[model samples]
Target: MDIPAALGGVSTALTIVKQLNDIDRRVDEAGFKLRIAEATSALAEAKLGLVDAQEDIRSKEAEISSLRSLLKRKEETVERSGYRYRCDANKNPIGTALCPVCMDEGRFVLTIQSDQSGRPYVCPKCKANFGYLSAFQDP
Candidate 1:
């Protein structure tokens, strides 16, 4: 459930608890039965709120895991010129140039393609062009 729904459930529980506290010392059997029913409903709502909170925690944990994995991949890449490239075991840059725009956004490192002139690299995913020395050129 969403945060607002969870909060609503908790709020309803608190309200019911306050009402139960305000009951008179000399209560009739029917009045006690009604209070018990209200308390049970409030408890159910509170349980739902707890379940929602647990689900939210699990979702956040999954997101954190994914971000950590992405960060690890980013750490393994090095930026050269205007593009990003994967590094070898020795930390040496390797493979084709990756889209710098995508890399900075924590997206996958899409390989930038070379045009006929080979003077600039173009990213197929974002269509962003990086003006740099051709990959075929000797540095």
Candidate 2:
């Protein structure tokens, strides 16, 4: 009877040890899962930041393109504004000062056409009397 009781006690102790080992393993697995979750959250935040940075870059690029276009138009206007000139009797170019009224209105049209048979030259758009030539360089 004593031997049988000792064997029974040993079996119970072994069962308890097995239960403790299983509990320890479960705790270790839970800790690992928590670390994975934290890492995943960090990755998601980084991706969001990258997307914002890309959008900023795109907006700046578009603004730069618009400014470049405006600059080109301004340069063309400056080049055309030089040397006051007007049209001739046959709608041709000759050396004459451009009408101030037309130039002030952001236009380069010249008053060269003789509307009243040999009267004072008149501008087409503003009808100003003076040399108002067409804005185009060609005739």
RMSD of each: 3.9, 22.9
lDDT of each: 0.71, 0.54
Worst 10 residues of 2 by lDDT: 72-81
Clashing pairs in 1: none
| Residue range 47-99, candidate 2, lDDT tens digits | 55556667777888997897777555334432235535544445444544455
Model 1 Cα displacement at 115 (Å)?
2.1
Task: Provide the global lDDT of candidate 1 against the true structure.
Answer: 0.71
Model 2 alpha-carbon miss at residue 103, Å: 16
lDDT of 2 at 138: 44
Question: What are the clash counts of all predictions, listed in order?
Answer: 0, 6
> Which 10-residue window in model 1 sums to the lowest lDDT?
130-139
